[model samples]
Target: MAETSEARASASAPGGDAGGEDDKHDERMLECNICLDTARDAVVSMCGHLFCWPCLHQWLETRPSRQVCPVCKAAISRDKVIPLYGRGNTKQEDPRNKVPPRPAGQRTEPENTSGFPGFGFGEGFHMSFGIGAFPFGVFTSTFNFGDPRPSAAPRGTAQYDEEQFLSKIFLWVAILFVLWLIFA
Candidate 1:
């Protein structure tokens, strides 16, 4: 009897009814727009609307072309919504409510300042010579049309030494062939 009378008195007080109602409204505002429960993994849309990420993700997936905020009907998207973070709430309580994580921002590699791939000696008017003797070697390498130019191999490398050895052999062979033609 006494408890009921006190409760009634409190409800009828000057600051009573309005204070209770305002507190209720504030609590309700934190609820998710779709689930109607306290929001988890909350996200705000560009339209100033709040929602749970899972709920919003499903809503957008349901109507891909017509993604919009449930509260304001304003445009919304997974990439466009900003995630809400609360201190000390990093760990989610419910495992079943987990989402596949938010979309990541796009990135690109810096432009290559070096000349086109395999075009060595670092940028400027380039010149090349054919291997072997004049007319024959000119046809062998200079007019190789459609074939790629071999970049100069670095000194002290096995390839550089091998190339030098091959050049010497070819020079001796060309000399011998010319000498034989003159004698014949």
Candidate 2:
């Protein structure tokens, strides 16, 4: 009966106390020992001493097979580091909540299109539109029949004039036409 009355009195108090909240906030701000920079990605050792991920990674890089924590001085042999990503830092989505469908313009490649089993495009007549090289070491010739000149010759090969070739073909065609007219 006495405990119930005390709880009711505390609940009825206005605005609660301010000093208690401030001390909790101050305890959350952790500082790294190495480099003395504010930790973005945190890693905590078994001794409960915290250090920034980058700072600890660099320290481990040059050391021998056995690695030790700078704060607790404990031996760390296996490649295991405890992450300090608290629940307050991460926003988790509930599994029961349904995500809305994205607009057409916002749609990207399918997430299931990874390199797992039954993942890639199958071998068939229908091929995906992509940039590919010709098989059997093939090279394409850039020849324009309308211009009456073959643009296949490389720039460094020889002197290439489109007008000269077109005129030559025209002269031969004219002679053939005259011959055909006379024979008819």
Using TM-score as the measure, which candidate wins? 1
Clash list (residue pairs), candidate 2? none
Q: Clash pairs of candidate 1?
A: none
* Model 1 Cα lDDT, one tens digit per residue, 1-184: 4565456667757867776667656867888889877787888788877788888888887897787788888887777887777786777443223776545657998987755664443422134356776567644543332244456556797756765565566567657766787798
Q: Which candidate is the best by lDDT?
A: 1
What does candidate 2 score on TM?
0.32
TM-scores for the candidates: 0.42, 0.32
* Candidate 2 C-alpha lDDT tens digits along 1-184: 4565457556645676666445434544576778655565777777776777667766765584558887777885224557666677764432112223223335577677546443332221121222345321111111222332324333343322443354466557556755786798
Q: Candidate 1: misplaced stretches above 4 Å?
A: 1-15, 91-98, 101-184
Please estimate how well model 2 matches the true structure, expressed as its whole-model Cα lDDT.
0.51
lDDT of each: 0.67, 0.51
The local distance difference test score of model 1 is: 0.67
